[model samples]
Target: MQQVFVFLILACVSSPGTPKSVDVDTDDDVLTGLEKKTLELETQIAGLKTEICALEMKMKEERDSNQNQLKGVSANVSDTMKVVGDHTAALATLRLDIDSLIQSVNSPPPTPAPTDVSVCPGDDWVEHNGHCILFSSESVTWNTAKVRCMYYGAHLMVVDTEELNTFLKIRLRAPDGNSHYVGGIDFGQANWIWDSTNTEIGYTDWRISQPSNGRTEHCLVVCSGSTCQWNDVDCYGNKKYICQKAAVHG
Candidate 1:
């Protein structure tokens, strides 16, 4: 197209007989066509540039979206891992508890053996001649005193031998001249008997001219006088009593 335009320009310049006005009109028309073509080319270039910019924008947007999706997937994976780790820890703890429970169920409890008794009596009791004796501080009737002794799982002092009688004679002496009842009582029998054992009295330490055999003098006592001899007294006599029990083994 440029060559054709150049040839036309050359023919007009070389033809001496061509009208000047006609040649000027042809040059104007050719210049106008070239300008129109240039305008069209500029319009196409601008449209291409617009399309390329729009495509670039779309690509950029797609890239951003893909990056966001990748990030979301990573976060989800991280959360899933955390949950799995927590579950694993909980399972481990439960397993440990179950194992401990099994071990406890399989094991038997231990049994305690019996312990020996102590040789010495507890407080408020005295050990003498293989016996534990407690002297009552309060005086009461013979029956009441016997009941008191029974409350302690004991019996009133029983003089079964000469040695025990002598011991009682020496120990029964009170500073206030107070007498203590013994386990001896006649009840309705001719012979004195032990109230606790219901057996005949084996020994006696009666004072001089004592045991008048009075019907009312059924109960006996270790008289508080300096003599400390066994004396018959009324059954209802209020006198302190002695309590005796077997000594425990240590």
Candidate 2:
């Protein structure tokens, strides 16, 4: 409208009946000024768009960088968790080993008793020195008597000396007057041996010609006396056997 008004004014001024002067020059200058202003506004808007693009790109870069860092951190945490799990397992194994070692180091050691204990709950088996002795008066086969003694967790008696003989004299069966079977006779090797054990023969009270290695004598028997000794006899001959076990036969 202003340009139109200027044109009308110029038209009027330049009319054949009218006169022209500096008005035209001033209007042209105003038009030039408006055009310059428009150009400047456009330049400023373009600069703003460029700056916005740069900022958006920078923001995107930062976001991507942060996400990458987060990923790294997450990976590190996963690795750390795995390491912790491994360490926990190792600690558990170490604890188990430590417990085993503690048990091995702190547990009680076995005593040097000849026999650890007797199965007879009532203390029926006599405990003398370190040996647990059980005397049987009922006449039985050598094997049967031995089995009975073992049922009580013992074996046939082992008479080593006159002292042991005297100790067993009180336990002997006098009513039957039957010589009991005692652990002796190495007839397996044609010599005297404690059939109850593979013990090194320490003490022996061999009656004269007692172990004659006779065919009828496959076993040995004992009686109480300073001259108490092993007598060879048939293994099948039933008698009251003296069954004994060591108190601490270590």
Best-matching candidate per TM-score: 1
C-alpha-based local distance difference test score of model 2: 0.74
lDDT of each: 0.84, 0.74
lDDT of 2 at 34: 97
Can you write out model 2's per-residue Cα lDDT over 123-197, one digit (the tens) per residue? Answer: 567777667776675877777887898887788877776678767655553653347787775655675777778
lDDT of 1 by residue, 1-250 (tens): 9999999999988987667779999999999999999999999999999999999999999999999999999999999999999999999999999999999889896576776654545788887777888888997999999999899889988978888877776766666555788788887455899887889887777888778768788888875466777788887877888988888865
State every prediction's TM-score relative to the real structure.
0.50, 0.44
Error of 1 at 10 (Å): 99
Which residue runs does candidate 2 get wrong by more than 4 Å?
1-120, 170-178, 224-228, 247-250
Q: What does the lDDT read for residue 245 in candidate 1?
A: 88
Candidate 1 lDDT for residue 122: 70
| Candidate No. with top lDDT | 1
Off by over 4 Å in 1: 1-120, 174-176
